[model samples]
Target chain A: MADEKPHCKVVLATNIAKSLLEEVQDGLAKIGRKPLLVGFLSSTDPAARVYAEWTGKTANENGFAFELREIDREELEDALLDANNDAAVDGIIVYYPIFGNRQDQYLQQIVSIDKDVEGLSHRYIFNMYQNIRFLDHANTKKSILPCTPLAVIKILEYLRIYNTILPYGNRLHGRTVTVINRSEVVGRPLAALLANDGACVYSVDINDVQQFTRGEGLRKRRHEVHEKPGWTLENCLPISDVVISGVPGDKYKVPANLLRDGAVCINFSSDRNFSPDVKEKASIYVPAIGKVTIVVLLRNLLRIVQNKIDAAAEASRENVSEAVQTSES
Target chain B: MADEKPHCKVVLATNIAKSLLEEVQDGLAKIGRKPLLVGFLSSTDPAARVYAEWTGKTANENGFAFELREIDREELEDALLDANNDAAVDGIIVYYPIFGNRQDQYLQQIVSIDKDVEGLSHRYIFNMYQNIRFLDHANTKKSILPCTPLAVIKILEYLRIYNTILPYGNRLHGRTVTVINRSEVVGRPLAALLANDGACVYSVDINDVQQFTRGEGLRKRRHEVHEKPGWTLENCLPISDVVISGVPGDKYKVPANLLRDGAVCINFSSDRNFSPDVKEKASIYVPAIGKVTIVVLLRNLLRIVQNKIDAAAEASRENVSEAVQTSES
Candidate 1:
């Protein structure tokens, strides 16, 4: 009887990422120039080095320029400032955890908002959390979201998790999601994004579980959070329609038996947060989303370039209007 | 049998506000000068006018200078820029709903961060939501909170709702709060603040309810939000230790029967949001917190002045260090 049970479909991010990469390639072709993305590397971590290599390979192959600048941790700030001022640099991203303290956070703020491809700056973070979609008052420019979280959202959409029949902002209405991890960079923002789209999200962390929802309304800019004091993974898994995990520890695993039958499961952690048997219970499983995340980073770079071009065009139009007015006067 | 039950204690904001006002007075005396707070009024709303009058009176009485600048809605941007440049103005507050849309939000961003006594600027809002307590990297300057929400926290503290035995940042641990309103200015920020302090807050609005909480960890910078699907006032009230309502409707009321026995209740709405019978169920009932809000506004003004002084001193010290380094080189 157990052998007769259907194994869940395993989805890889490569195909999804390839299509998105094609879209980026098309965008770059229209621009007629390779937009330079400068990557700041100050960490000795092998993982960071590997990620940088991958980013460079992908960018160079896909009609974009990628430059990796490896510098000492102490000189990273000066390097960042130079990158920010460089006319050729369209976007900037730094491999984080250089100092692994509040100082690292300070360095994030050092990246200019205009060129910050990582979207870690205060302005972007604030806009994302507040659900402000546009950068300008007139809504001409769209605000950038952090790439990793945006990657998760894109994957979910690709998996047909977001219902298309529903209205634009409330596409995930009636969906119940459980997100494991509360990290500021990835997990927290992912949960917020899910909730903003109208999913009831159980934001499970090491300490406790919290529920994130937008409540039934079109006017809500962002999701709301509620604390679930005594809730455990066991408690959430049984009720969750979708389970997303990003716990960074290799030893940590979400027990497959705990998941609701036919529930969709996704993991974004570098370390496996789910066991091999997750497919037995889950209707769909995404093993990794790193490829999608990289493409999203490239997408953000393109957006930065587009925003700059738009601003310049707007400025020129204003200048022409002012000149005409001055001549009449 | 219900007749024997004791009526709850009625807590007034007057005494609490008086003490806080004295603290502001002492702060001004130490500074040896009054900090001027400029209020921008473009709304024809009577409530705005009365509030402005109250602000002016309270500010003058508490050793602070207040100026109400009535201007056309169209000139608000220029007026805000003028106040931002004015050296005499230590703080600036704008009466909201001037344009009653996204434009009003734009006006909020127009006030300079240094002179934004209302704490509605992007920097303060971002800090508040992220639970970043300091204005600067060195943690010398404390970030400011919006006045009305700060008043709610102060009221809760006065009621001894915060457990002193618990560690700082976790004093509101084990508490369940329900805040009925999700307005950007007060309800949402108040929920975030309480959750950051380790309380389980169910943030309710006209459309729906969401829970806000910081998972049990000292390292958690801000509260995570969760959506509560199909949750109602009846579902939350019995579990909540505190019920706070700021619903701006004359007929709105929190049914006394729904609240947990001996629960604390507070209403910041202009209209009474709770009935007289609520005293029978509540341990403490606070009908208003307007006085406390005004004093908090004044306190924010003092903080702006202090932050400016600190920045100037730090700049001078840096200059002295640079001069010494130049001579040595």
Candidate 2:
């Protein structure tokens, strides 16, 4: 897999174990309390059930208590509230694609922010995106980011290229990364995260594919002072070092010819956004693997739960100190 | 200005007033109440003070009660809390570019969501972005969006080109639009808004310009099925019908030669991202005229204030009816 192409390497799901273990150890140290996670699965979606089952299995294997509850759409809020109130239930995740339109988000939003390991609440989304927008300097403390994007970041971290500078001063810090889809779940947040890490991210959508052709009217807007001209994918890809795609479909969204040799590609969607022959021309190819994703998801859940426990402990200690001080006074 | 180019049309500050007035009237009918606005400025930033004064002047001219208050950074939270507690103050705006690192956003975040005319709070940011992501189909009602992005939207509405389809089936819906900067105040929010409105948005950062070049190791990960390839600015702008820029520096971020003929360019930045000569090639050139932007900003403030008032009135009525029912029972 590592010798697939001139510079391309293929990473498998098993390669994530070391990183996962490290995360678990860190979480254990930070979280002084046992963690229990409840996965809310609706019977209407078989896919959701499979994902929940996988999560549950992973959770149990990782020394965390995990349970999958079969829930109806109407009972989702009640289930969420119950889990939220249950002291033992440290985290709650409602699986995606509920039967009714908008029902998935509707139920997900009701999950309490503290227990929202999936980061579905508006508060989490806002803080995460704001943190990204402000270059991570914004004071909004985000507990957990969405699983898919976080997983992608973890994958890059595992690759040892996300932050490390190369001998030539090349790194994600100044690299151009194109995200082939703009879905809120994966592409959008991932782009923001990459941008936050100092990668120049260009987002592409298929519906607006027609707008890329060159014509007479095309020109870069110039100011009185001199600056470099703007870019398009046609001009951008020839210089790109990495391409990350999340558009799910049965068509090649990225051509092999567009990529230069030694560039990396990471796909996190159902369909191949890149040409199969891309391996022949690229440095690395990382397809979205469910097993790896689940591990990453579990890692994030544990981290969040541990943070919550630590926060609670710190608050309690502060209260105790306040009471003791009052007595001394 | 109109004759500067064959295709270019320069829209002056006055062109927006008609639409602004129409929006105001419709808002009044929908709001069904008078509104009050408060502008908060820190003494540390001179630019913030000027903007606040302009906003106050516009607010008073538009028949809404407006006040500008200069405050110290330490008093920001207190002032915000006061505005939040004030029942009569329907809208509150904190002038931007607060001195010190991240203090602007910190103070902005303190503004109440109901009175966040500037959309600085995480709640407002999340709701606005989510609203855009869900294409306004999300049930989570948004009280207000970031003023600058909302102003851009209103400008498109005034142009009558945002939603209306062209003879070739091209509209902003399926067109490509490029944003020159990624600032939270304008670029990021505008991209989200445009994406919500169905346009494919490409964000460009001049500081991160080096990343766009194609190099070795570029490849896309493929799935069992295939899809089309992704794009960059070189491919995107040739087909773009509109370009919105918000890079605020003396240097030109976009060159006139990168845009297509007849494409409309809207610059919300102080410096012209587009060259002065771009008027000859583009269909329309809309500069960041202070007067026009102030009007748009005031219009958004008025709309948000009215919405808050209406919501308050509705809540009051519901409470009254509930009280009556309890008495009768």
Candidate 3:
């Protein structure tokens, strides 16, 4: 009895990442190139160092090239620009927590949209709307989505397949998904992506009430009345089929009883957003594995960008053929 | 009984349009310009003709310039380009249902994003995401939202005050808004806009299931799992706080029994989406008045574009001052 393992199915994020990395390598090799990603660490943050180490190791094991470099805050722009201009660099990712009190969001624009593996550029964020338009996956070739959201999606798919007892599979349609964080990096984008997939996404946060839950003083701001509903963590988690939290701390936020039976719990925050007993309560629990998710995310971006590049080349060939025909005639 | 009027208050869409127009005219006048719009009617459809006529009358009554031109199908692009190039033409609107069998979606792109008063351009459409970013209202000066959605928002605001019987005023936060159309011109954007504000938006349509709801064959299309739950016309109407429909045609689509008492009904379709008896059941009913909404929309767009232009000018002035200071130093 002491040796018996827990009854719940435990899914490994690294396994997901490894499978996706293989697919990406194959895709890049088909295009006569190796998977090359440049990781820029502009700060000495502990989290940043860990990510850089994992990325370097993963790249080596998968027969790919990963360059980890430390760039000063002032040189950050030049480093990104060089990567952008380099024909060999397939993708560029900047580790967060750059120097000073501000986020390094300004650097996101320096990376070419085509080579933006992090999916932080305005174009990528904007093009994410294409999903809502129901354009085929091919149409979304214009911009890559952020890694965390993409990882959340993959994990959800994984849970659907792994949890055979649950009636609802990977399909997000009609699934009540409650996202506990409303951040730009994880929670907000995940909500949008999930909603686009037809999931009833309840994006919950502590500060969502004044903005989402109650209509008030909507006087002079006529056309600006649009605000997303905010649900408290306690109220929304109970009803959620899939509960995802990205709160960036070590505290256990989600209670044991909050997650109903057969529910799937996913944490993106490096810190645990769920209680230790959550694994025992829920049908499936996906703990935060940033390294695994990042690998998978970069792989997805590589494949998407390759498709766009291939399509462009094909279009150019067609144009050349048409010009020759017209000239001959 | 014949002499007794219903206890409900009648909300006129035109009043809202007129007030907005006044504000727009004042805004333009401050910039030493008048509200000038050119309406290009490439189709002789009765609805298009009606819109053109109403636009002309409203422009003149508001001490603005409105020019209505009937152009050939082949000349549509040229006319739009001319308006785009013309400094006199502050706004350009092409009536729907152009000479072609298909909707003239291509023409939407021809209008520059800045001059696109209809908010049809891809850039403007994509940028509506700013609301999700919680950017201040002043920041949204860059893009104009689609007219129908803007009008729906305005109507909701109007209903908030007009429905004095209800304790909640003009705020849409926390309200469950059900949009009964999935078309880009209305429902989809409306849902995004509403959800951006704080309302729990339920986007419904007849065929949303086969495409957006069910997630089958989601393997190769990992990123393409676009699912929007399709709530049949019958199922979702009962739970909505504000029910807005853009289903075209003359027949009524919403039955009286579907709406809960105190629900607000809004129709953007020329034909009734709600049954005739909806007025009796709902606390307030706002019928689609295309002409009035269009005026309000055009006014809102004019103001937004003017603000952007003014903001740019102010920025340029500051830049020039800074440049001079640098050179002197």
Predicted structure with the largest DockQ when compared to the true one: 2
lDDT of 2 by residue, B155-252 (tens): 76666545332111112332456777877677877776665454556666644321121112211111011111454567656546578887777776
Model 1 lDDT tens row, A1-329: 01233335678889879878888888888888889999989988888898999999988988888989999999999999998899988999898778888998999999999999999999999888777888999998989999999998888777666655344666665467899999999888888888877677899999999988764332345777889888899889876768999999799999888876557788999999999888666656889999999999999999999999999999999999999999999
State in Å the error of residue B131, model 3: 52
Residue-level lDDT of model 2, residues A1-329, one tens digit each, is 12112334677656765566667767766665557788888757677778888888877777778888887777778888888888888788888787556766677788887777776678777756544222124533435778888777777767654433211111233245677777778777776666545455666665431112111222221101111245445654655657777876676567778774445678887676777777765556787656667776667677666556556787899999999999999
Candidate 3 C-alpha lDDT tens digits along A1-329: 02223223446677667666777678767767566788898877897889888877877776667888788878989888888888788778788878545446777778887677777878678656434331246554444678889888766665442222212211232245688778777777777777555355677766771121101111111111134554465666665657788787676488767665435678888888877777654556777767667677567556655766777898999999999999999
> lDDT tens string, model 3, B1-329?
02222222335677657666667678667766566778888886897899788878877876667888889978889888988888777778888888455448888889866567777777677766434221246555445677878778776665441222112211232245678877877878777766554444567776762112111111111111144454454556655656888887776487767765446678888887877667554545777657557666567556655765777898999999999999999
RMSD of each: 26.6, 26.1, 26.2
For candidate 1 chain B, the 10 contiguous residues with the lowest summed lDDT are B1-10
Candidate 1 structure quality by residue, lDDT tens digits, B188-253: 999999998877799999889998975432234568899999999988997776899999989999
Best by lDDT: 1
Docking class of 1: incorrect
Clashes of 2: 58
Which 10-residue window in model 3 chain A sums to the lowest lDDT?
A214-223
Candidate 3: true interface contacts recovered? 0.00
